[model samples]
Target: MASREFLKILSSARLGDVLAQQKLAEAYLTGAYKTPIQPANALIWLEKSYFSVTNQELKDKQTSSNSTTEILTQIARIPLAQTFQSPAFGFGWTSFWQLAHTKAETQLHLAAKWQLANLLINPDHQEIQAQLMEFLKGKNISSSLEAIAGLDLKGLQKIAKQFLQELAETDSPFTSAAKELLIKLQPKNAALSSLWISWLDDKNEEALLQAAELGLTMARLTLGLRLAQLDGGDTKSNASLKKAAYWLELAAKDGDRDAWYALGEIYRRPQFSGYSAAESDRCFDRAADLGHAEAQLRKGANLWRKREKSDEKVRGLQASYWVWQAHQQGIAEAKELLGKILESCPDPQKNDWHELALQAEQAINHHVEHQLDEDWLLLCHRIVIANQFHFSKAELLLCEVGQLQHEHCVVVDIRWELPKILPRLIQIETIQQRRALLAAGKVFASSDLEIEGNLRQRRYRFDRVTHWLTTTFAKANKHQTNTELA
Candidate 1:
């Protein structure tokens, strides 16, 4: 119910008032009074005030609260010359017509009347098409037709096409809205059309399953897809159909990549109770090419598991490729796995392996801080350092590195004392050069160095302490002198 004050405002608003027009437009646009203020009525009065003799300041009042560009465009398109003349102009011409085809219907009637009048006056069928063709010569009617091809009728289609051609370059959402409105106005086939749309807004698996059994293509596709994904050894009774394989195969053949992927997975990964690896690989291979990333990863992993060197090399490369693609697209696990593989590999570097290693480390840190996936943190640390240096080197310096950790340390026997002469052989260069040598498991070998001096008994401790100080002091002095010169 509107307040007495609102009703009083409306009564005053009807008498050619600009403030009233603005207020009424707001009320209608927002449903201010809970009184079902019709937009059509509000638009008519607002448009009237917009074009009439009124104070510029009052008439130009526009709100920024809501901006539906399509609605504004449609409102702007209405001709002011013939609007609100009388009921004869049309039945209730207003903003409500923007939501329906009535306004277009009225315009169509007018256009038809002009065409009919011209035809009656001239009465030449050949001349009519020739004149129409001449009028539309430069106009690209095909593009216009394509835009409104969704509309049902020839007349509205023609008009919409022409309108689109005129506004081809304009930024408007009206074409979509107009096309939707045209669909609403279309005549329907009452029988088959009743069940044309299938909605599933709630969780009712049984209903979906039953529908699928009854031969609804969508339902069959859904259920067959799901059944194909069940772990290989479930009870036979729950298999849904003895022809389960048949329907799933059919769904896959029908361009359902998910179904194809699912079918491939089933055939490839059958349990002791159920498929063979060879069968599963074939399915996975097909699905992978059909743009299924999971299938590609699965196929690659499966191929690597077979221990066939040629296949292992191919699959590892492909697995890395597909996983990297997925990782770049924001899949976190793919990113982590790719990082690990890149770090572990010894030969040709296909990507920035170190960057990926850091990515894995940072991601693991984030996860660990949130207590989300603590396992990845340790794994990330191990892989990153291992990739930066040799495995033994990384393991030995694992304590020095802040983020990476191992589950446990195992001592491996060395046959003889490490050559202390090796450090003297290569002059200590960059900090990174020293780090690289140390990480390659040199620390473990260096532990055996014999200190033949006054510090002989505490040789192990003395040598390590001396080495640490010399490396640290040397790097610090180099950096300091460079800084001082600068």
Candidate 2:
């Protein structure tokens, strides 16, 4: 049931109106104006509209070129009129006419071609397949595959297999999708499958290597992993490492995330691949970009570690972005790391503090429900420290502070009278304990030095404690300093 307006547009379209035909085609494609969903009708209208635009452009090109150029110059110099004079003088009329007389023909051609390919799904139609092949000759393979997938056609497995094989031979971003399709098409008793099975069952390394060389993606990754982890036969020898790297690099080129991550690990270990930090980071970045969660976490952690050593603000923000991405993807370890990073962040803006508090609350709730004892404890310490720095206002911070007070009350008392207690309190690994001891030391530093008879003994012990605490604070501050953005 087409609306009256749509009927009028279709009437105008049949009378050879290019705009009306294009509108009618859009209406059919979108089922607008109560039109039934008929892709065939859409394709027909699109083709008619495209040919009409092409005829008009050819007619315009046949006119005097000097006259057309002069008209374009005059149109470009004229500003918009204050009031409309005629429908022909409407806004954008000149530009629209120019575009339709020039570029619109090509655009319409491509649109019609895509719509036709999308509508034609009969694999038996040699004409349609030929048209598709012609259109896809120099186009992006991934986009072509996506258009084909939308057709949802049956009985085209052979054609699809051929396309996948061609894509697999190319070094395109769609290589992974092509490899996956190839694996799906592989027979259960294929030679590559048998070789992979043999290697899995009996550690037949040569069989796996042969299958890998035969373009089996999984076999390449498996053989690479096996070679990387090989023991007792010069495992870290240069030749062995180079061979492992070769296989891993091959798999990585075919868009295997695990292979990229494994290469990153190999390059990180100096004993394995001579320790190229830049190459390791690059591999980790590639894997992370390919949607590997572990790679994201590892990259984030390494960036944070490096930022500590270099005190670079850019690195800190980069670390936070990666860690936050991993956390959003539900990586548990990422949550704890992000919480600590946010807590130690100094002088963050209001919005940053708000986000930090929210993340802390979420981490606390998750760790409590899952009974992740170690993670919960670490987050608790981080929350308390964050509250000390005013980075967050989580209620769990108060609870942690109370627990620290109860556990270290005696140590706090001794720290005031005896400076030797500083080292013992600092030896405790908990962040809360160390922070409390440091606070108490500040209090002692501000007090009077009035002593009775044994001033020399007291001063000597205080000097030793002062020296140790100074060295420890210097080292900690060096590593834990806040990143200052310019």
Candidate 3:
């Protein structure tokens, strides 16, 4: 018989008690309290009980066919069928594919499953190995047994081919996943074959640039690094650095703080013949504005590096803010600086550095669990508050971030842009017989920016912006949701 206490705990858990639910699940899983082994009973009870329990969502709202139909009905009532009708269905494996590419690890199991399928279909592909390696290297870890799984004869043959190629090029015999796979594939040949080194020469600038422009973030970082090296001072030195800086700027604009550090280096040298510290400071400030942890630390150090002691001292609070942000991002130098700053100030609660430090730490933890920080929300609020100003790009970003937050940061004013507006007009005009001139090109987002009747007007379209935001945040949401279910 189940103990009275365990039964009470399970009942409470079903009534929305998370801790109780966890305890009950653990008890059942472990066969505690002299319970007989009962996987079937445990699975059934846990599934039903957990579904009934109230829980916070960290992912996008999952759509069952039933729920999706209901949501579409409610949306139709808003008199904006065009806006309400979406192209893609709710979270599915395709969505999972898009998210795993972005390294948003809210749903490890789902991501792993998607990755497995991808590898299976395109076995022995170099691009796949490279992508996996890049993701792993960023995390400072190696070896993903989950990435390579048991397959049938055909699959194994394909895997063997791919594994041999990877091992041939990889340097470290034991540590390199590719090298290890090669051993498994061809034990005799593996010892005799020369290690592969030509893959390093696979840098294609045009492809990299194209990927960066399309918002493949790793591509942006890679392009930036390659440009930073100036790689033996080729004839294309200035062009290389400038292009690198531009891409880095875009990355920084997209909330990448490390890009700012790279920006600082590019702008630091007069010999590089680029922007000055003051000019670079703008980029750094922009980076800091977006919570780039290391960017914050470097901006502070940049002040001291330039011998701008007065400015540095005056901006101590701001510097400390970035320092704390850096510390939160795991920058060792920033952490040491923050420690020294805190020791000198000795304030219990109100120290600016201390407060910012706490906020930064909280922000990282929130991000890890697929939650947006309040600071990001405030930035979105600033955009919304500018309803009169109407920067469509800013509005689009708000909507994008809101995907994870579930309309938390969405501003209602996004309906004003020409890109968004033109579509609505087309839908309505089809209902009414509109003139050909009225339909000619009908003000598009790329139409123009102009002043109209005392309101500052700009042509904005949410098409690309909306798609980008949805693709990115939907993935994040799905990841979190899958994690919860797992």
- TM-scores of the models, in the order given: 0.28, 0.34, 0.27
Q: For model 2, how does the per-residue alpha-carbon lDDT over 1-486 read when each residue is reduced to its tens digit?
A: 669999999999999886687677567656789887554455455556554555564555645354333333323322212111322232222232233234433432222222222223323344544544334333322233433433322433344454456556666555555555455445556887888888889989789888887767788888887788843344466666788888898889879999999899789766764679889889999998887888999888988888757664223556766776787789999978877654332332333333333444344445556454442334333443443344322222222232233221211112224444321111133464355435534433444323211435434543443354345345544555554321
State residue 225's C-alpha deviation in candidate 1, in Å: 3.7
Positional deviation of residue 218's Cα in model 3 after best superposition, in angstroms: 3.0
Question: By the TM-score metric, which is better: model 1 or model 3?
Answer: 1
**What does the lDDT read for residue 281 in candidate 3?**
76
lDDT of 3 by residue, 78-114 (tens): 2111111122111121222333344432333233222
Q: Which of the two candidates, 2 or 3, achieves a greater lDDT against the reference?
A: 2
Count of clashing residue pairs in every prediction: 4, 0, 4
Q: What pairs collide in candidate 1?
A: 268-280, 270-275, 393-439, 393-441
Runs in model 2 lying further than 4 Å from the true structure: 1-152, 162-180, 187-193, 210-218, 226-243, 250-258, 265-277, 286-301, 308-486
**What lDDT would candidate 2 get against the real structure?**
0.53
List where candidate 1 sits over 4 angstroms from the true fold.
Answer: 1-199, 202-218, 226-241, 268-274, 311-315, 326-337, 344-486
The TM-score of candidate 2 is 0.34
